[model samples]
Target: MEDRNNNNNEIYALIIGAGISGIVLARLLAEKNQKVLIIEKRNNIGGNCYDYIDKNGINIHKYGPHIFRTDNGKIWQFLSRFTAWHEYKHKVRAIIEGKEIPIPVNFTSIDTLFDTTKAKVFKEKLISKYGKNEKVPILELKKTDDKDLRELAAFIYEKVFYHYTLKQWDLKPEELAGDALARVPVYTSYYDGYFTEKYQAIPQNGYTKMFENILNHPNIKVQLNTDFKDLKNTKYKYLFYSGPIDEYFNYRLGALPYRSLNFEFKTLPQKQFQSVAVVNYTSKEPFTRITEFKHFFNQKIGQTTVAYEYPAAFELNKNERYYPIPKQENEQLYKKYLQLAEKEKNIYFIGRLGEYKYYSMQSAIAAIFELVKKIAT
Candidate 1:
């Protein structure tokens, strides 16, 4: 990799924000023998997926918990070259009515929340209508004709999703886009796992180290503590931006709304803090969830680190943008910026912030795969 300098005459691509999208694209372009320069406002790469081993020998996710799960074999294989897998399946629990139950309102969750007979009836009704192992969206479940099923839906919606959505996005479930609310579905079976992807695991070492391997190429250069606006005169064949599209245009139209997060990390002396890796505080808690980092890879350590995630409004120059608010007006405003982006040549807006869409880690990489295929061809 080249050293940090203002020289850009030999650069073929300039990627802003050294997140997963930027680093992956840089690696891909470098493989094609194209000179790529990545500028990041932060000193580190991996963005929200960044993780590091602390003194207690626990791999702590700096932002929050990131579990890599993908159905796409090609995308998984692409990342497999960088690091070995830990082979982990994440399980999450949410506190509802002072009892810990599996999220997505699974069969076990139903049993824990409801009486034996009622839980049996609810499960039977759900299976009769949607079939076993089918994941039903909370909203779609509410549309059922059966009164008992509708009652169960109401119970799950109120206990599991309603307050959680409000705390996470500062908006009610109905206010946000349908896709956002559908992410956490009602599982019809006894599956207690958080995700149902074919491949679910974490990097054996860490995300940062894997990213280091990805960026360890001769043609790729990384410049830390550098913003794209500072490189006004640098010349590049193409520009791939992963930062907020509104900020790229200096918010000339208007600042796009986003949700930010603040984490209170604590290293507990005990062997375990929670039974599961993550526990959502669904009711009456200011913070959304508490993540136990040691469970990601089951690292055998005496000390465990947990992060208390508190959602907040995205303030300029205050905190990092985590989630883009998925309201209709926000999408319409994003389109305005998209129009301006289309007019620019050799420039592509990729990833969550750039596209103004909520993307899982796999989805982000999948989007980049398509972008690289189009550009490389």
Candidate 2:
């Protein structure tokens, strides 16, 4: 960790991990006449949203396809200034039992899976049974002492929810949190769009270009392939850390559990492959989903690229951090770290990994804006 103290009158801010949140925070602080230095462990800036051309000359996301979508008008408008809009709306389908059904498992999917008479009867039964309360967890339904409701709940649990959740998280449905299950919204309508957010689209160029624009200011200096541990002895006025909360403190409070993913990208000599952008495999397949790159960017190219995502156990050093497992045990562990974070006055933990919460890209940017506002006031 080489620390060169620049004798500048401006406020010095050190941001760890040049991810979306980190970049946004740096931009906001730099605009306020603060001297900002962004240190990224990876050789690139866009973190999980990073994309580049593969050996086959096909542009692919290093992590996965990240579609920019949010209901916040300010966030949408703000991102627009960096890159032109692609005018793309993402839709995903799940391949379950040899059939491709619209994801979020809507009315059309249910109808397609079952016979017309049985489907109608089942729909009526569900409406009459659960009413307009909206579907909760299978466990919640199982708690009902009523035998028939419990049976129905068990049926849905086994058929619809169990295998898919198991494949996605690599854990049993009962082992997972009710909150995780709650995040999966069940729709009665034929809406097949993956996200229900009002404003949804991707950048025309790429997320990398957008991030480059964000960090292009004079006051912001970027250092890639630099780990936070490398700068342990460095002195800064304040630190904005977007890396794992547990890793920040050397996991003294025990490593906060996280779920990781393994992506396998393949190139083919074809224009198109899948029907949609993303296809979820809900069965017991080793790979959970396959994504076609062209569907995401709507690029007209000769060669095509696709990625097969496989969910795996998150080892300490082997895997790239993806999803944070927010079970009761993990939450208790995070609470200990949260207390530690409060004691550290000079350090501010932001974004999903830092705060140990599942946040959308828009929510992460909104957090930066909030922090900037607080600092200004």
Q: Each candidate's TM vs. the true structure?
A: 0.96, 0.89
Minimum summed lDDT over a 10-residue window in model 2 is located at 1-10
- For model 1, how does the per-residue alpha-carbon lDDT over 1-377 read when each residue is reduced to its tens digit? 22335245568889998889898999988887788899998888888899888888889899899999999999899999999999999999998888899987799999999899999999999999999999999999999999999999898888888999999998999999749978899999999999999999999999999999999998989998988887777778788999999999999999999999999999988999999899999986999999998888787778889999999999999999999898899999999999999999889998888998888889899888888888755
Give each model's whole-structure lDDT. 0.90, 0.80
- Model 2 lDDT per residue over 193-302, tens place: 87778888877778898899989998899999899887766566888999999998999988888888999878889989989989877767788789998887677888
> What total of clashing residue pairs does each candidate reach?
0, 0
Model 2 residue pairs with clashes: none
Candidate 1 residues lying further than 4 Å off, grouped into runs, are 1-9
Off-target runs (Cα >4 Å) in candidate 2 are: 1-11, 55-57, 124-156, 232-234
Q: How many backbone clashes does candidate 1 have?
A: 0
